[model samples]
Target: MDIDLTRTDIIKIVQYAVGGRVSLIGVNLSGLDLSKLKLSSVDFSFACLKNVIFSRANLCHSKFQEVDAENTIFHDATVSE
Candidate 1:
């Protein structure tokens, strides 16, 4: 299911993720402003993240395997090996 999520929906999901209430897996977030958002441990596998801004976002331990990250900005975003 390719659901086009709005910015508000993204924020809500992030909020829930912060509280360990939900997980964003395989969600298509193409062309979204995700800057400064804390998204630690979120799963982005096979997700469309083209042109998305993840600058300064806490993405430690997040999964981006097989994701379409074309033109995606991850300036200063944290990631673990």
Candidate 2:
């Protein structure tokens, strides 16, 4: 299910989908301005984040396996195990 979502909408959706078990495989959020997001426990395998701005975003416990984040900016982003 591909949805045309704004930056704010993406933030809300990510928040809601992180409650427990959420699989976000093959999601294409390329070129989106997700600079103010706090994502956790979400599986973003094979997702396209090309040219996406993730400044100051909290991406704890999020899986980025096999994802293409080319040209993505992670300025001030806190990534951990």
lDDT of each: 0.80, 0.78
TM-score of model 1 (CA atoms):
0.83
**In model 1, what is the error at residue 19, expressed in angstroms?**
6.2
TM-scores for candidates 1 onward, in order: 0.83, 0.81
- Candidate 1 per-residue lDDT over residues 26-68, each given as its tens digit: 7788889989987787788888898899999888878888898
lDDT of 2 at 34: 79
- Judge candidate 1 at residue 35 and give its lDDT: 91
Which lDDT value does model 1 have at 58?
Answer: 85
